[model samples]
Target: MRKLALSDEILLKVEKPARYIGNEVNSVMKDKEKVDIRFAMCFPDVYEIGMSHLGIQILYDMFNRREDVWCERVYSPWTDLDKIMREEKIPLFALESQDPIKEFDFLGITLQYEMCYTNILQILDLSQIPLFAKDRSEEDPIVIGGGPCAVNPEPIADFFDLFYVGEGETQYDALLEAYKENRRCGGSRKDFLQMAAKIEGIYVPQFYDAVYNEDGTLKSFVPNDPHAKEKIRRQVVVDMDKVSYPTKPVVPFIKVTQDRVVLEVMRGCIRGCRFCQAGMIYRPTREKNLETLKKYASEMLKSTGHEEISLSSLSSSDFSELKGIVTYLIDEFKGKGINISLPSLRIDAFSLDVMSKVQDIRKSSLTFAPEAGSQRMRNVINKGLTEEMILEGAGKAFEGGWNKVKLYFMLGLPTETEEDMKEIPRLADKVARRYYEIPKDKRNGKCQITFSTSFFIPKPFTPFQWAKMYTMDEYIHRAHVVNQEMKEQLNRKSLKYNWHEADVTVLEGVFARGDRRTSKVLLEAYRLGCLFDSWSEQFDNKKWMQAFENTGTDIAFYTMRERGKKELFPWDFIDAGVTKSFLYREWERAMRGEVTPNCREKCSACGAMCYEGGVCFEGKN
Candidate 1:
């Protein structure tokens, strides 16, 4: 039996002791002596939140399938346990074997959100490994990072030995093979990294150098090593049918954020929203075969015994065979106590019809992400949603018996005006009015319409990458403009309004567009007791501000200024299959308040056609 990493006395004192214990169902265990490679996969968040992530699960299953490899899972210890472990001087351990992560061959951390940057440092500190990649020797595990944030890895470049540039499925086999081969030949850690740098989709940050101008802009970025490519090409899996999917995922001991079976209906999005990084980075939308989804859905449900199943994708509605899969799920699991969850759907009659069958109307609420209040603002962001369409969709949903509705919007978008800010509540009021238009006897009750606004942060590889961000006070003022307008509406009592914290948004904006110079500030912030910054109750804005002051870093230099078209960006060396010229053209169109058509409507020749698959070659011979 594997011994618990923590003592019984310590486990009883902390909240959620199960988080630290191993031996969950379906978790892989192997003899350390027999396996040639030991991999520790981590999501730098709490166990519940990390377990809910599908990306890590897929990679875990894929890696463990190899006879010579043994993969395990790790998560950032909750604050209660974190203090205990530090006091006890216990090194962080992976869940499956309860062995110290320092014993592993590789430590792969997923970078899903910018707020979790401090937690990355926490992981390294607890594992008793060197925080900086340069301080490590061959005895330490090779710390690597990947996922959406890897598209802009410069901000945390010094902490990681290497970064996987794109989708994991396509290039991981070669990377693992190279690692084994290098070890067999008795190569040093640096020698192995040099060999790995030559593989596609792998980035060795130590081998690269960044130059800055006097104006605090990127002067140039170049590779110092001959093996490193001038531009790291993002790997894309054209044949989704051949990719691995985890049917038997590990079941958590406690309920999680997403305690359900998940089936990915597709990859990428056809919608070209200018401010969305996922839409741009995951281009040339590719989808799985309907039969493949059906098989995975049934297998995953049976293996986990989950009552709910969610269709995962950037935009579920854009899946060409959506109706076929939804119909199949409803018909097959209708009375079997299985619930189907379909998110990211564009509200339409077809969607309403399908949702009405699967969801309980009284318990569920309809959601619409118009992203902007005014149609003009929507066009500016290329949201492609109209007022008439929103009202019509709300009316249909109300008639279908869903009285609770949620409206999502973003503040601080380019070209936003006072009128645009005020229009957000007015739009929600219009939807509320549409609901009340139905007869009182036919309605469920007083309709509750909730509208939420989050401050927008520009991300890399998107059209808004060069846009200027507002200060915390400015973002709050924009939210206040919308709140004051809500008071004047006729349906004021029926509507509720909420906005996200501006402090986190400000920090996230700085990190998103930040360069290599920002690493020192990040290091200082982590040292100043800034872990779990993403949690509202634990976040300390003063500590972060002091860290910036301590490191001589100017927040305005990263967030408050706009970039010139000719200015070089820190992420310029990444070839995400979308050309810089194309992004600039879209930025120009956004400034003109002209809406660009989605990928299905027309091809703008954005350079995603280089993939030569998916929607890019849909009509070509």
Candidate 2:
């Protein structure tokens, strides 16, 4: 496939022109003639957002670092661009070289969010690749996936030939290097996948066969190769500071989420929230040094002309040297127009102070994630947060002259009761009091509070893996309960209660924890115009319901039926680091309202670091 050189007029006629053009400072440009394998790192989204993602940059750096491999970027063009590409008969092309994606040896997509599922399919079709793995011939580009979503790669399992279960920092290069050798031997894609599967952390879904029971529940998944490791240990890179990272983030032609240099201060979470797939999948937390971070940020800003920099991680507050990093960013970027944003902030006084220090007092809104309303429920989920601590943080926020607070919670957790449901407003009222207590001069005086709750979704590798989630009716009723309770106490005008319609999150939980049986419903949903179901505008509950009804599978089978500890999860054949016993023990502790200290504080012995020859804690095995 020849590269279609889009005229300046045509490139502008599509959408964000950044999607096509390349050659930013520090962007990889290897000799296509010398490279043995060319990879198109396709993000199933647009350019601005894709350029902002740090993982894409890291993998881009990792692959292109190998002289034998040249990795380029591919993104889903916007609706207007897609139409134009189809009309112009133009194939999807990579950013750096303006080469057609069809010419690449490998095509990898970051399956970051479930919402991007259809977009992934669209990219494949646009790239002129087969949508289903089975339909593709051996000569087709080897399609693979990575990210937290890949842990339960069931819904899209039929699409990707390989799924990288955990960290890709080190394993990505090893897999490519191995593939390069095999390519020289003229090996088939299957042989390449088989060999790649042998690399730690890569799961070749094709090597395993899934079986289901009569009720459409996942019965078991059997690996065709007995010698194949059932559990894929998550790939961990020791000394995260030394890993290949994008020193100069891609400068976007338009605004994006971060649109700036992103430096990963850390990887993994120490606060083990059971509902979080990333927390479990990214075990044994690791961090980058403050000096290296400063250098990266300095270099990136100077090279890319970025205005804002972000410290990327699952939870930024968990960084032991967070105080120093925050202090450094504040001191450095204060005079310049540069701003630093931290995602995944844990709720606490110290973390709040960090937020307050870096952000302008008036412009910043307090964001808190209780996850659950009541303490008992929080304990059951091992949130490691107390009502008192959250209220204390709220008081500090109010004292800081903030007028609004956005609180996040989850409904439909196991063992949830009406009492727990009422706590949502009870907690909100406490925060409201703190707001009113502010002195008249500080008060511009009107205070607003928003309590938003999302329906809980059980995921793979968490303690709740075997737990049954709430039904739709129960979820809706509970959401209403919190809303009514809050409405009655606070002025309806002063408080805003927002809850997600159970339709999407419930289905998210259903498919996320579901097995190969879900493939039928997924296909039916797609056939029934459920494509782009992630979009609020396009998601149709009626179509999804019909699809499920056609498959003779009720929502309860996926969302409400609790499996026993002994039963095999449909994804059992696919391992996401951290042992089952560790999750079970954590589950037991949660049931008794027990608290497991953070990994940095003490090693919980989840068996996450046994293979690493040392414990991941500060200093223990």
Candidate 3:
């Protein structure tokens, strides 16, 4: 019933005045009396960014499909906006109808990354909700989170009531309907979550008691409820074609990370790159047919009038009928001013055919992630792509008239030798030489070569599960070594060589594969003003270090130590469908400099098979 006053002098001066506007053309509106459940979908960032997210758009549209449930969008204010809200004493509120967030029955946050952890607490405090799960009562909004980061929700476990592990389409609505009926019968929050936890893919952290050894390793996690299952399966949509998704996406007033009509053509990836968390998490690729995709893309263009459309997936090039999809899109939208952007094209020069669609208009940098420098190191990570393939791809990218090329490699992969890293610059030099080889008459643009590299982090449930992470000092030292080697190898300084901050990258590794005790450090860091840790301006690594010190937990305890093959990991309880032996075997193969083929060629026997009830891919039947 309450609404934010637009005439308020303080509200006028804040950044992005559109963020506070409760009404948008495409947003759903519901009568207060009409809905049984009021759900607030929160993204731990400002509205400008949240409104641009495809996941939030999909979930918002999906939930609004239900007549009985009302879902609206909410986001954390940027520092400037937060200042005005705090000064004006404005509590964090939903965008539509300006309803105080506390009024919602459920607060669902998308934990996309670890950087959003502090922002989560900020939203809770401003909503007049208790920060800790144990401190909240039946009257408070039940806070929940879901995303890839939910795989290790322990760091922020005390803040959320439960975590939805995987795909949300089927289970979210199903859970909401049950909650509405139970609330009508006067059920408590505990009763609601306990009942919801019974649904597949729902993980209630409160209902489990976690026991850790003195060494900080997890002893066991015992379930409190009788119906609470040990294996919290990920929710999946078998027939994505039949699923109700948003054909009309919300068009942002400002440009974002992706300024295009976004389409998730597939659910999972077939390539089992050992270090990739997404490949492991979103297992068993399920795709929507070309007919459905064409329909959706056409509908989105008609509704939003967007200039570009991105066919997004782990590997868009790997789409079985990718050539057909792009050809059809270009044909149907001819002269409409809408172009296509492909995220993952094989770096092979053979890919120039796909690159020709919008190559002349879009002059962005080319990206190739060979992962490791040498073939042996590449095999150890099961990257599968050969050196010849990378060179061939780079040659094509340069020959295709792209001005800048980015070569992506990792510094501290398992079994990486100085000799292995020495090959990285050698490869970059070859790519650079290829760029200069173009004929003088054929060259239409200036040539530039950019090489970027990152530190490797060992992840849980992957082949690297038992591997030790590179120490911060070691990672930095090796990065310097790469730069030195590049100079000696190339004898030319035209190339731009860069690496990410080792401190932030190291912390990310600690959080990525950490367990329950890490929650203490996360909480302490948050309490000490550590939100938006992903942003360069807001992140204070020293503060995080202090938090770890305050908690008496060493970073090496999580990152640097190699676990025994038989040891129980904190996340070992949650099965992603892949068995433990499979991960261990992959680790063993990596140690022996062996490479495993992809799921498309051979089944690695990871547990994602449980999603489709057969092999993960739709046609695998």
- Model 1: per-residue lDDT, tens digit, 455-482? 9999999999989999999999999999
Query: Each prediction's Cα lDDT score?
Result: 0.92, 0.78, 0.79
Decoy 1 TM-score against native: 0.98
TM-score for each model: 0.98, 0.92, 0.95
Q: Estimate candidate 3's RMSD in Å.
A: 2.4
Q: Is candidate 1 or candidate 3 better by TM-score?
A: 1
Q: Which candidate do you rate higher for lDDT, 2 or 3?
A: 3
Q: Which regions of candidate 3 are displaced past 4 Å? A: 5-7, 610-621
The local lDDT score (0 to 100) that residue 516 gets in candidate 2 is: 60
The runs of at least 3 residues in candidate 2 whose Cα sits more than 4 Å from the true structure, single-residue gaps closed, are 1-26, 83-89, 215-217, 347-349, 549-553, 610-621
In Å, residue 487's CA in model 3 sits off its true spot by 1.8
Of the candidates shown, which would achieve the greatest lDDT relative to the real structure?
A: 1
Residues forming the 10-long window of minimal summed lDDT in candidate 1: 612-621
Error of 1 at 39 (Å): 0.3
How would you encode candidate 3's per-residue C-alpha lDDT over 112-147 as one tens digit per residue? 876677788889988889998999988899898998
